[model samples]
Target: MLLTVSGPPGSGKSTTAAALAEAFDLEHVSGGDIFRELAAERDMTPVEFNELAEEDDQIDRDLDRRLRDVAVERDDVLLESRLAGWLAGDHADLRIWLDAPLDVRCERITDREEKPLDQVIEETRRRESSEAKRYREYYNIHIDNLSIYDLVYNTARWSPEGMLGMLTTAIDSYDPDTDEGKIPVEGVDYDF
Candidate 1:
């Protein structure tokens, strides 16, 4: 089964995805991390990389398609990405959306980058808007809405243990063949 985790920047998607993958013993891949690695190989800033991603639709689509194909063939896979659920087409057994407040996300960005909170907040906001616009224009994808997900979680209120509890329950209850369960992860925290 394929489990896809997605969210905006600093939404704890990576942490949750990693934890879930470890606990579930699933293969994991993070699209954002992959993009960052690729960018570093090219010595590009996030803005420059995003610009290139915007220009290269086939490259982005192909990467996602290949990843989805792998997920489909694998016994268990966890995909962490901004657009994994959408890109995975019908292969994803569960699509989880992680979310947090703008202020919380800003603080997370500041801490993660070691930048001033205000500066990081502004940059993050700008990045989010730009990515949203670009995704819409390039792939007709609308990520602002949360309804497309099989599950939605607000990490601001739930502790990591709480998240794990919810995920465990969902995994236990979810039927891969029939999507009929609610996975609610609220207020999940990460030590790292």
Candidate 2:
């Protein structure tokens, strides 16, 4: 059971992924955590490392390659990242995209990073814009397009626990033998 959780900054993806991993007893991996560790190793902030990556595309490629490798080499893993859904692609049993309003996301980030709301908002905008440009140039991917995802949820409307419950229910109800996995179609508005 491989799950990929992809979302923009502060959409509660990491929190939901962590909970799902625990509930399902799967190994949890976060691309952002790995990137942050690498950034710290080089004594640079995430923004600085992202800037460096812009100059050297290998950084992004390497991270994405590692993600792909993990999907191919492992099962019972929950992978979380901005591009996790695309990287995992058909290999994932469940590919979820979480979204929230920009203001809500900014507020979450402000609380999580202990930064001012305005500062967090500006930083998130800059970072997301940079990532979108690099992802387009590097992978020919349009990050804003959610067509590839199996399930899309608006995280702003649910608590982390609520989201987890909904996801677990969906996972539990999946029937692999019948090829009827209760997977939601792209662009469908889910009442949950």
Candidate 3:
């Protein structure tokens, strides 16, 4: 089962992906971790690296390419990234987008990063804007659009455990051969 979990900053995507991987006994790969590692190797912070990437498109391209490669090479892997769903495309058995209110997300970021809520809010806004612009320019994809995702979850209302239970049930019941387990992709819907 190739699962891709995508969301904006502080939406609990990493935690959710990790939990999903454990539950399904699948390898978990995080694009954020990869990006952070690269940034740290260069003695730069995530914001600094993100700013640099705006000028050097190759940085984003390379990271996205690596994600694609992983999807192609691995069969039972859970990928967590801002663009994981887009990158994995049809290869992913399940594509989930986690959504949360901006204030809620900022609060989560503040708590996780041990930073002031205002600072985290500003940082997240800047980072997301930069990424949205770059993604649109490079891939013709609007980050705000959730049309491509198979399932969208509102993280604010659902606790991590609740979300996990929902995902587990979906995964357990899914039948790939008959497409019986796939969520309907018609309406703009979210699972709470």
Candidate 4:
């Protein structure tokens, strides 16, 4: 079973994905983690790395290509990223989108990153805007579109454990044979 957890910054996507991976005994792969590692390796912050990515599109392509390949080739994996739903395409058994109001997301980011709320808010907005532009430029995708996903939840509505429980219930309730949840992404060529 392939599952995808996608959301903007600090929407509890990683937290939920980790719990889901444990609950289902699935491999957890996070694109954000990979990106962060790359950033750290180069002695740069994620914001810096993102700015570089905007100038050098290859960075985004390389990371996204690897993710798309994994989604197509692997099963029993929980993929987490901003664009995991689009990247997984039809290979995913279930695609989930988690989001919250801007203020709520900014607070979570501030808590997670241990940064000032003002700084967190600015950086998060810049990062999301950069990603949205890149997504459109490379894939012709509208990043805000949520129609492709099977489940869309607002993480602000629940605690970490509560969100996990709700997600697990949704996953358990899925009937692959009957539910037509795999919405194949079309018109965008994933040219790896």
The lDDT of each candidate is 0.77, 0.85, 0.87, 0.92
TM-score of 4: 0.97
> Each candidate: RMSD to true structure?
6.9, 5.6, 5.1, 1.1
Off by over 4 Å in 4: 179-181
- Show pairs that collide, candidate 4: none
Q: Candidate 1 vs candidate 3: which has greater TM-score?
A: 3
lDDT of 3 by residue, 1-192 (tens): 899999999898998999999999999999999999999999997888888899998999889889989987899999999988888777789899998999999999888889999888888888998899888778877888887887899999989999999988988977778765544433321111
Lowest-sum lDDT 10-residue window in model 1: 183-192
Cα error, candidate 4, residue 89 (Å): 0.2
Tell me how far the alpha carbon of residue 45 in candidate 3 is from the true structure, in angstroms, after superposition.
1.9
Candidate 3's TM-score reads: 0.91
- Candidate 4 residue-wise lDDT, 1-192, digit = tens: 999999999899999999999999999999999999999999999988998999999999999999998899988999999989999988889999999999999998888889999998899889999999999998988989998999999999999999999999999999878655457778676865
83-183: candidate 2 lDDT, tens digit per residue = 88878766788889999999999999888889999888887888888899888787777899888787899999998889999999988876655645434
Candidate 4 has an lDDT of 0.92
Q: After superposition, how far is residue 153 of candidate 4 from its true place, in Å?
A: 0.5
* Candidate 1: C-alpha lDDT: 0.77
lDDT string for model 1 (37-146, tens) is: 77788898665676677776654666566666666677688988987777665667788889999999889878888989988777787778777876677567777766
Candidate 1 clashes between residue pairs 3 or more apart in a chain or in different chains = 157-187, 158-186, 158-187, 158-188, 159-187, 160-189
> Which of 3 and 4 is the better model by TM-score?
4
Clashing pairs in model 3? Answer: none
